[model samples]
Target: MNRAAQAVVMFLLGGAVLRITWTDVYLRYVKQGLRPFLIAAGLLLVVAAAMTLVYEVRDIVRHRGHPAHDDGHGHGRSGQLVGWLLLLPALALLAITPPALGADTAARSGSALATVGESETAFSPLPPGDPVKLTLIEYGYRAVFDGGRTLRGRQVQLTGFIATGPDGRPILARIMLACCAADGIPIKIGLRGDVPDLAPDTWVRATGQWIPHTVKDPVNDSEIPYLEVAAWLKIDPPANQYD
Candidate 1:
């Protein structure tokens, strides 16, 4: 693309990224830690846009008395093509802001193993209360590797979407990520005992007792756990979908 067009594209893309990051919009797509990176990237793009504009305007002034060419737009077909190509991503961002991954993503990658070499944790006791609230991923880790030792007999509540495994068995699943949606990993808690025939991606708060069962995670060659559902409260999707 010509310098001016390239600058505009970069500016738009960077501005959009900054806009999303500055607000909560970016939380749906990436880990919270990327905030500074998004800001830096956006600033760079805006600077580039300013520099390109200055340079192009100077060139035009230098040729102030020149005759116009037949392609009166002053841009070649190649430049237009490049500009359009660059526009695609910006346009996409403007058109549809993707919500965090839900049932569709869970079903697609249900069996993904979040492998960790044997690192045992000694968890502190749940705060002196029943129905301790837990992020779905923390519950999963405690359930599986810790042998459900901490969760036994305690009432716990977790919120996540209803998604099924490859075998079509339903689960309460949440996305776990180290950086962004691109690196998201699925953490699932198999649901048993009076689960409703709810649609996939239905958001709910599941209250349950952990009934520890030793089931092998075939993919990771490790043991995983399931929950004995006591109740399900249908709810709207949360502002944040990852744990």
Candidate 2:
């Protein structure tokens, strides 16, 4: 790309990154622990773009009214065309940012439970409360790995969008992220027999207890956990989508 085009592309890229990180939007894709890195990377890219702009100005002044030739160094029309592609990602981020990962993503991923040495993890009592609030991942980890030992007889409240299971049944599902959107994993809690059917991506808060069933991942023969939903109501999607 031409120096001027390169500088503009860099500016847009950097600005796009900053726009997401400076606000809660970044939380939709990655963990909170990555805030610092995102901010730093955005700032560095912006600074580099600014420096390039200054260089471009200096070059223009030094060769006034005599633009540099197409020396196969991005001064040609072809270079400018390719440079425009850099704006695609920025425009998408700034103008048409995508919604958080939802039902479609969960359906594509076969497994709902992911635990490391779950058998060895010791059990702990539910925090003292009439209804303990917990993320879906937290509930899934404790229920699936510990055999629902900590969740037994305890009323827990979980929030997530509704997704349909393999058999086209409603399920309380949420995606957990280890780093960013690309590495998200879906977790689910089964609604009790009494709970009414809900549409896909319907955000809701369900209060319930662990049912302790062998929820094999239907797509794959994998063990997952489920909660016996007692009560639930529709709610707006949370500001942060990832756990």
Candidate 3:
């Protein structure tokens, strides 16, 4: 395309990437978070737009044989200047940083981009009373087969997101992503034994015991050392939700 058209196309493409990367559209529309790298890309886009604008104005003035002088003084340069002015918004966006990515909206979006299934798989032999560090994904895998058979009646620690249930109680939740953060699936565990006092999406380290019970889907349940609340820290989501 010509300079003007190319500039417009690039600007629009940058904006589109920003939207897809930051929003859940990355799941349904595309996959991946493009927001993290946009700052540098936006800078380059601004420079390219500026250069293209300059060339386009020059070309327009040369080709358009419009009124070079109205009242022997006015020139068609005014039209070209006005056209460049219209591109101000596009230029400003490249300079101004956008907002950070927002948390997933469960209502509007409904669950994560992916979903976990009831796998009939059990965990390997874990000694009793061992402070095992397990992620939400690991817990789900164990739940698949008899709710963690080998690790049954053992003490373990689990970490993940806090999802509120219908009764307004916090549930240990984590998301399983297929590709990037966009296509993630939410996994939940009813905090039966003990849980930390944390907000939704807040990361925490649980230091407690485990008790296994035969329940419905995700069959196994653990009795955490409810009283001994070790460390309740907030952190960013981990790279992988599933094991």
Candidate 4:
């Protein structure tokens, strides 16, 4: 492709990156800590593109009176076509932002139970609250690996999308990302009592007590914990889907 076209592509790609970052859409694919780095990279690309475009315009103006000549390579058409193809990713990002990873991703990966070290087995007493809010990962760890030692006799709240368990029952599930969606692992908790018949990917806030029983995840053979859901309601998906 010509230098002008290359500059345009760079600008589009950079703009796409900036747009997502500005709107907090990047949280779907990456951790919050990477926001600054993404913003910087996007700005760099945009600046470089602008500089290249200015240089190209200056060169064109300087040579406006010269007769055009072409080397017999005849590669311009093919190169332009390839350049157009490269614009699709940028266009997609700008026009059709993809939804965050949800039930389908979680089901395929299976339940991921965090391994508790010997030191981790002795969990601290939970803070006093009628129903303390906890992340799905924390509840899963306490329920399965720690045998609900800290969760017993306590009501806790969890918010996550729903996914079907190995037994085809609804489970509250969240995707835990180490760095990005590509490295996400699903943490699932089986719902024992009065789970509503909701479609997969439906986000919910549930207040439940630990059931103190573990079930085997057929996909990965890891222990899956159960929560006796006392109350639950549908909720909008959070801005950041990953934990």
> lDDT per model, in order?
0.78, 0.81, 0.51, 0.88
Identify the leading candidate in terms of TM-score.
4
**Model 4 misses residue 225 by how many Å?**
0.5
TM-score for each candidate, following the candidate numbering: 0.85, 0.89, 0.50, 0.92
Candidate 1, which segments miss by more than 4 Å at Cα? 66-76, 110-120, 217-222
- Tens digit per residue, CA lDDT, model 4, 100-150: 888887788867784545454767888997799999988888887677899
Which runs of model 4 end up more than 4 angstroms from their true locations? 71-74, 114-120
Candidate 4 clash total?
0
lDDT of 2 by residue, 1-243 (tens): 667878888889889989998888888778889999988988998999999999999988999998656565446667668779889998887987678999998788866574476354766788898699998878877877777888888889889999987667788888888899899878867666556477899998899888867567766556666677788889988888777
Residue pairs in clash, model 3: 26-30, 119-144, 120-144, 121-145, 176-185, 211-223
Query: At residue 170, what lDDT does model 3 achieve?
Result: 62
Q: Candidate 1 lDDT, tens digit per residue, 8-29?
A: 8888898888888877788888
Over 4 Å off in model 3, which ranges? 1-9, 12-51, 54-58, 64-119, 122-130, 180-182, 197-202, 214-243
Q: Whole-model lDDT for model 4 versus the true structure? A: 0.88
Query: Looking at model 4, which ten-residue stretch has the lowest summed lDDT?
Result: 114-123
User: What is candidate 2's TM-score against the reference?
Assistant: 0.89
Give all candidate RMSDs, comma-separated. 3.5, 2.3, 8.6, 1.9
Q: After superposition, how far is residue 230 of candidate 3 from its true place, in Å?
A: 8.0
